[model samples]
Target chain A: MNTKILRNLAFTIFTCYVTIAVSETPHWSHDEQSTWWAIQDTTQNVPLNYPFGECGIGKHQSPVDLASATIIDSKSLNKLAALYDTDTAPVFFNSGHGIQVNTSEDYSGVLMIGEESFPLIQFHFHEPSEHVVGGKSFPAELHYVHINEDGRIIVLAVAVDIGEENPVFGTILDNIPHEEGGQNASSGIQINPAELLPADLDPANLDYYTVAGSLTTPPCSEGVQWYLLPKVITISAAQLVQLKDIYTNNARAPQNLNGRSLLSTQ
Target chain B: MLIKLFLAVSLSLSVASCFAESDGNKSKSLIDPSQQKRLSTDSSQQKQAAQPNASTKSTDSQSPQNSNQENKPSMIDFCRKNPC
Candidate 1:
């Protein structure tokens, strides 16, 4: 081989190796959740430790059982306020874990919990809800994930029950991509996040069960403020079946409260 | 020299192919039989928990008209009325 050609070939090989090693991250799956923390990166022909080891040792985890919560007077606390645009063309994707809807870059929905306001990042669905209310689990749960300027996460959760068919939820179900990692972005399909809630529940005077917890998914990053609405929204049994067919049993089991205070709004 | 270049390209393609295969396999192996059983058990437990009881109210109150009333029941009311 020509000397220069051989040198370039060697460089190309080295670059490919480096790129593959750098891009390959540890994979975590719900099937083997017990071994999530031990998931290895074998791209470099070596088992590298999982980067997000918090899943194994987080003190304050999420999806805590609300049955054991202590109700506190929320008269002094500011009412829950949601300022969402009625016409948002969101991109719905199947994340393998659940059906997640991502808002557009210009989407300006804001959720106000007390005085603090967080920007709505995205929302997702989980079947057989993560939070157990009064020792009972709902048919499903909807988590609206938000983040503030300081990177604080506030997840507003709504319990889903089997009742009347929600047109908005039906629209979401109809548009959601079935395959994992598949995304459906239809500009014609508009959704109002507020409509996903019970029509009668006032956004300003919303009552919820608030607790300090962490993300339910892998990495299980702590310090997330969770506000779960006790009042549930309904979907028809057929709608529930549609949702379950997409992603059943995606919810993480409830974690220990660990001395955390579960407060309720008035 | 041409043979040497061919070998080099083949090796690179094989490396890329291996990584792609690994990625595909990771997703395919997500839900095994044990995970399916666990999912079933979780569903059964959820069904049992969802049964009606004195502590829990009927889903009828979730209606638009009922929930919009001035004296709409709050989580506090539920906690106070029940032993939760």
Candidate 2:
């Protein structure tokens, strides 16, 4: 090989090494959830780890820019409450959306209250949703998180996208009780919140995507019950802004298989 | 060796299921540390199977309203009167 060519290759290798080391420096300082500490110096807390090793790792790592993917619009989303033997009845509560069914129990979408739980506490939405499908990221992913009495969370992630304005999402966006940065935003809007759901709901249409996930908040705990709907919902960019900050990126990038099974309920 | 490999994969799967179960359990608790601590008691673990069994029926049942509210009368004790 010519000495000049060899020298050029060596320089290229050197540049790659430098780039890697620089990238790694930010990650090394992150917490177990891979989030950098909330320091005053940092302007916006973005994931230093671009692609996480696990399927879900960071707390604020939500799915973003949702206009790209194709989602199946099934009728099942409408009847989710009826399937779990639930009352699409809405119960009022202090915080969160959806309805509080029979007592304080309520969550967004239809939640099946189980035995080994803190009982399903509530369901809510994060604007622009979270979770990505295949390699395509959606605008929003609604998380139907179930909590047992133990305070453990099993979050079923449903990815939403941008499309024609649906009445269900409109209800949610319209009645949203607490605006994120607003003075009155302490709690979410409460209504017979089940109305904000897609009609003709089919859990089967929701192809389950699972992986080890962490909370989207501090102390980002791993081992979450993640269910990603194969079908994405359409949400206008404007409607999404009403839920929460689209820029916060409240979702973890997909985690590694780590030899994990991504089960589909269908 | 192939059999052993199969067994190994099976073992990993079992372990993953346990992880999923635990993760599933964690979904509700991730909101608050105090809420989680309340759930970590030995009594709650005992209720684990009972809970999913109850929830699974609700989860898979075609009638979303009829799934698990069978014990609704007792839930009043749970909601307003209890720590919920």
For residues B8-81, write the lDDT of model 1, one tens digit per residue.
Answer: 99999999999998654321111122322111223333333111111332221110111223322332231111
| Model 2 docking tier (incorrect/acceptable/medium/high) | incorrect
Query: Which candidate gets the maximum lDDT versus the true structure?
Result: 1
Docking class of 1: incorrect
TM-score versus the correct structure, for each prediction:
0.69, 0.43
Interface RMSD list for the candidates? 18.3, 16.5
Which ten-residue region of model 1 chain B has the weakest summed lDDT? B59-68
Error of 2 at A7 (Å): 76
lDDT of 2 at A30: 17
Residue ranges of candidate 2 with Cα displaced over 4 Å = A1-34, A37-110, A113-118, A127-129, A177-198, A203-207, A241-248, B1-84
Q: Model 1: residues >4 Å from true position, as ranges?
A: A1-25, A42-48, B1-84
| lDDT of residue A32 for candidate 2 | 43
Q: Model 1, A218-238: lDDT tens per residue?
A: 657665667777567778899
* TM-score for chain A as predicted in candidate 2: 0.51
Scored by lDDT, model 1 comes in at 0.65
